[model samples]
Target: MLRRVLVELRRPQTPAGLAARLGVEREVLEAMLASLERRGYAGLAYPESPTCGVSCRACSLKNLCPAAASEAPQSPPVWRLTALGEQFVESAAEGG
Candidate 1:
């Protein structure tokens, strides 16, 4: 069965969001995310974003963005599904 952690990552979100959604502690979520990253199911939207960038709220790649494209701010990392993750989730959904 697909893990709930992996399923929750179908959408990109901050670490805090993931924790809140799963109702788990941050440490547990971090471990899960690390494992997924090692297995290649998920990763940061972008390795990094422009320093003090603007909000990418409307763009599809916004999650990866470290900051909005405008000016004066930054955001936390956004975890997202990789190609393999998408395939995994899709196949899982289809199977069950």
Candidate 2:
């Protein structure tokens, strides 16, 4: 399931999109995403700026950005494959 998730993440996608594509619940997908992030397999396409925090509500990118694992907003975050993740995907494609 984790590998399938990684394969789907080759392109940027919101959590909702991912969930729908994988046929899983949003909450379950979020948990998997969090696990991948912790293991350095995947991460945010655009991480929140250092200055941004709880005040995301006031930030102009509030609707454009996805919060880290700590905050599981219903709004999807754009997730991407990390370097190692990409390599893994490529290797898998080559039947490695």
Q: Worst lDDT window (10 residues) for model 2?
A: 46-55
Tens-digit lDDT track for model 1 on 1-41?
Answer: 22787788766677888899999888888888888888888
TM-score of 1: 0.69
Judge candidate 2 against the unseen true structure and give its global Cα lDDT, from 0 to 1: 0.72
CA RMSD (A), model 1: 5.7
Query: What TM-scores do the predictions have?
Result: 0.69, 0.68
Candidate 1 clashes between residue pairs 3 or more apart in a chain or in different chains: 53-68, 54-68, 54-69, 54-70, 55-68
| lDDT per residue as tens, model 2, 15-85 | 88899999999999999999998888787764443223334456444554455333543344577677778
Which portions of model 2 show Cα errors greater than 4 Å? 47-75
In terms of TM-score, the best-performing candidate is 1
